[model samples]
Target: MTDDKSKRDFRDRNRVAGDEEYEVGYFASKFGLSIPQVRELIARHGNDREALEREAKALGVR
Candidate 1:
């Protein structure tokens, strides 16, 4: 469990570029949400790259 958590953590700080556009799933893992939950939240009170970085700073995900 711990390892899975950390593995996702590792994925967050440095986002995967090119092919894999950094997604809500990435943020969800960082924030302990289910993928569907993350997608839903994004759908609710929207934010993309700039907002996502702002959120990450607030949450201190890195």
Candidate 2:
């Protein structure tokens, strides 16, 4: 079982871009990353969720 904080954090981290355009601040907060890191992720991997996840994993992020 997950604690409330863990559950909330999971929900927050799992946020999908959906129909909205990716914003650096939004993604950064959602993924627990910095603005510059988010920009670098998007720059290196584009805005695709899968690609971003893969790259983030490779970089040892959540």
- Reference-based TM-score of each model: 0.40, 0.49
Which ranges in model 1 have alpha carbons more than 4 Å from their true place? 1-22, 48-62
Question: C-alpha displacement of 28 in model 2, angstroms?
Answer: 0.5
Highest lDDT against the true fold, candidate: 2
Instruction: Encode model 1's per-residue lDDT on 1-62: one tens digit a residue.
Output: 12244354454444322223255557767767566655554554465555554564555454
Model 2 root mean square deviation, Cα atoms:
9.2
**Candidate 2 displacement at residue 6 in angstroms:** 36
Model 2 alpha-carbon drift over 4 Å, by segment: 1-22, 57-62
How much RMSD separates candidate 1 from the native structure? 9.7
lDDT of each: 0.51, 0.61
Q: Candidate 2 on 1-62: residue-level lDDT in tens?
A: 22355344444444434334455566667667776776787776676766776776666644
User: Which lDDT value does model 2 have at 45?
Assistant: 68
